[model samples]
Target: MTKTARLYKIERLIRQRQHVSFAGLLAELEVSPATLKRDLEYLRDQLGAPITYDRELNAYRFEATGGGSALARSTARHELPGLWFSERELYALLMAHQLISGLDSQGLLSRHLQPLLDRIHELLGPGGENDSKALMKRVKIIGALRRPVDATCFERVGEALIRRQRIAMRYLTRTRGEVSQREVSPQRLVHYKNTWYLDAWCHQRERLLRFALDAVQEATLTDTRAKDVAMRQVQAEMDTGYGIYAGGTRQLAVLRFSAQAAPWTSHEEWHPEQQGRWLADGSWELTLPYADETELVMDILRQGEQVQVMAPDSLRAAVRRRLAAAAALYVGA
Candidate 1:
């Protein structure tokens, strides 16, 4: 039996009988005397279990619950909570672990969550303790496109967000080719397309900005409490538009996908507030609001001739120019 299982069973035996002899524990656990002794010591020292040996009874038992004894006065008895799980529930937990571990490859999240993961393995029943670890081997996470976030920066950013405090950051906006120092109140953290983003109210710009974590050169938590913006306002300004670009939406991009592309485009959620309908001819018509066309335009170009920007001349013209530029590369090839 695994040490955790043995420890759990030992506690239960003691609590049930109110006292259990060492020989009885060896028989029930089928472990060597030395192993049982180690388990008992671990239960006391590591788990804070207030287990004590009674020489008169020649057995082990919990210290009385009341604060009368020295052991009871220092620490209360610890109980290992029951972990009963249906097969399906266990599978779901394992799946969630796999996915979370994939998203958190750096062990940033895994370090804090390892204890809970251990408890999960202990639930595998008896000596099947290795089962969860074996399952972990079978499940693979491919993070080829993942952009690594600095561990220190991520922690400070997360701490400031949870503590409701402002943070100072030296930001590098690659798109603009500029580096600026700013103090911002982190409103939310977004993990989209294999990267982390901080949605914050930029103090310098005095507007909402989505700063990619990869672009944050440095972060320092501040004592000043974060400026709180209502969720409704944040959603309107930050989320209403397509992708990560932020602002109150200025225009809607209406698109029509060919029948072949409709099958896929109709089912995709390009934006939270997007509207889509199937035309009589089996094409898909999608209209979504956007404050900036930068991201929306790239998505359109990927479809090549399979999609068309149906409305708003600006978007159509932009797509045409991109297709023209891309085709120009092959002009003399």
Candidate 2:
């Protein structure tokens, strides 16, 4: 039998009996004692099944706290990895992996998780020349307007985030074209549109601020511990507005889309609390909150004549100014 099939059976047997003797597993699997031992090890060590030998009970059983490493213990709440994954489920996992791998443009995450990915590949195609690898090879994921990030700098930021440590960084604020040295307590790391943003409590600013990792030229972990903030305050400060730039006092921007753009824009979600409705003329009207106009303005400009800012004079003016500037570039062209 294939190793994948045998592994599935071992998980099933242990779960069904709650405990099973080594002799019984050997008999049921019809494998040699050494092979059975190897299988048990693979299940516990590789797959993190949390199955341990209860010497007193004289059988192998699931323990609430069984693991071979810190990584294993972290995932103890999950069932055995890929033991019961159907072909369709395995395909979903592959698709998700591809999406996430694209976000990690530096390939740091993919390298660390390659072993599990390889196991999934093997389960899908034991011969190493199968449809799974071929399909992945055929697909191309393009992240539009992506900025390259320094891998070493990003690693330092991630390490501080996971270790809950404060970091000192030299940041270049593109808007002002100035560099500043700041100490920040890393709170949350956000990945959006192929970029990494760290939402942290800026020690210098005495408030929450999100820093683009690419803009960060230098990051060094500090001995100070990260100041813990409640999730509620974090969301309130960072997630209440539209798009990636969500913060500050939110003002609703009402937009009307032309009939030509309604078909596409109607299905789009601008924010969590967005409201939209189709008009009698086949136009679409959408209302969403925004704290910053940087990203929001870019999206609105994309719609061109198909969209109009209907409320909040400030946003309307911002769009108009951007449009005027764009038109100026094309004058006499």
Candidate 3:
């Protein structure tokens, strides 16, 4: 801790306790009695205070001079709020400060938060510069979204989520090759594989759906609100799958992994309900219960020759049919 930080903590302790003994201040500030006395003298002499030790109180008491109250004088010298930050919080604060500072230089910091940033700078003590730089080097947070969403849309969605309001959105569906408008009760925003998605209850289809934020061309708030029962249902449905997409029913998905992929595959958590067993032939048997096949198929295809679908004949047939079609394309070429 730096001198300024120690002084700030001392000031906070004094204010909170009204009067603090030299021994208590020494323990809290972790400073020698001579140092604490010097600090007190400095506060009294330089800062214009009548801070003196009282035998009856057995602590230092701030006397009110004719000019102003002792509390007011000490506060005027340093008004920064003394907050105890955990390591995780410190890292988060450092990251946030870096982001805002970068955005400020680029003329993009939010107007509402600029004043708050200035106040933060005042609270940061002498060693804060070096501490912040070291923290920035050690910590990092990455956004998963491919492209940044429009700030305005992002703000609106956040507001909608807070208010629990339904939204009518104009969205482009790449899979269906269609642009359609639908009224959906916004449930939650999810991030997966660097993309942002909005999970909502579709009024038209009477089902829960997840739509990519980028795919949304336009959004308008609706007067119709989501019922508690519907929201719970959507939550329950989404919780059943690995990602946002969930099928109507759950199925047992079995996969066989080659020896080469077994070690890597065993270490990962494919799903919450995933279970794996080592086979005698140096292969691995893995089972995951999923509500959707779309995401599962993608997972299997990514493994290529290292993994094979074993059970739920439908999934195997789908994988084989897709692979055969892909192979036929290569043969024709």
Candidate 4:
């Protein structure tokens, strides 16, 4: 039998018996002891199956904790189809997994992603586990907000966004020190840097507004329903600002990057319409249309001297004003 066929048979035998000795596995697969041992090792490491030896039972058994064999089987079946994913879809899935894993670790989300992980492994094939581990080790999600977040508030906002429900929230505004209540139709939940924000249409204001989820002191779902806004329209509005608050009409913004930061900046997809032009001086120009400035400010600030806003006097003025305020902290020095 082919190695792949033999491997599958070995897996089936283990599933049927719960545990099987090396000799038994060899007999089942009609393979030699040495070949069976090699197969077991491959299954353990390559396939990420938690196979362990039981001295008392005199056999190899699946780990009682987090047995992933069933997940693996489901994953294999899904990948058999000729379904193709675009690069963006793949990246989005990866990011989603990373976020879910983080939430799971914190007890905010249930550990229900075993099947998804198994599918990822199957899609990745033999080298999937290694590649995933390596990629996760290097990539990290960081929130730009300086304050600590309330996990409950974050989860609530996400739930509301998913359910397509309007929410009544007590929000702490930056300009207003006191908490204000508003009924909002949540359009999207966005994570930028380390902070989470909800883009919603305020029923009171009759306009779109972005609320920092962490700043939400209370959020109660409302029974009153509204027309579901298209994600594209919401995104188009948001691209107008730096963060989530898209207060004005959409405008095109241009940014010139210093040579040192151009390479790293080019690797990111900042927005759907983002386009980059490499300059002769080794610098780069990135142009994209945006409707908001809140998230954009944080992004530009993160780049420091490696980037400069080239167009839209309003955005430049916003950046300059923020820099001046930051400089105030050093007045004593």
Per TM-score, the best of the predicted structures is: 2
What is the lDDT for 176 in model 4?
65
Q: Pick the candidate with the highest lDDT.
A: 2
TM-score for predicted model 2 compared with the true structure: 0.78
**Model 3: residues >4 Å from true position, as ranges?**
1-12, 15-17, 20-82, 86-88, 92-124, 138-148, 223-231
* Per-residue alpha-carbon lDDT of candidate 1 for residues 258-282, written as tens digits (9 for 90 to 100): 9999999999999888999999999
Please give, for residues 131-250, the per-residue lDDT of candidate 3 as tens digits: 756765765445432455555565667678878888888889999989999888778877566556788778889877888877888888777675333656766777787555775688
Q: How much is the lDDT of residue 137 in candidate 4?
A: 68
What C-alpha lDDT do the candidate models reach, one value each? 0.82, 0.82, 0.71, 0.70
Question: Where's the lowest-lDDT run of ten residues in candidate 3?
Answer: 101-110
Q: Please list all clashing residue pairs in model 1, or write none if there are none.
A: none
- The deviation in Å at residue 5 for candidate 3 is 7.0
Better of 1 and 2 by lDDT: 2
Which ranges of candidate 2 are over 4 A from the true structure? 1-3, 10-84, 124-129
TM-score of each candidate? 0.76, 0.78, 0.72, 0.58
lDDT of 4 at 59: 83
**Sort by TM-score, top down from the best:** 2, 1, 3, 4
Ten contiguous residues minimizing lDDT sum, candidate 2: 70-79
Model 3 steric clash total: 1
lDDT of candidate 2 over 1-333, digit per residue (tens): 656677788878877776789999988999999988887887777666788887876987777466587435423443666668866677777777776677766786767677877878866545432767776776668888787688888888889989999999999999899999999998888888787899999999999999998899988999999999987998898998777886667788999999998999999888879999989999999999898888899999988899999999999899999999999999999
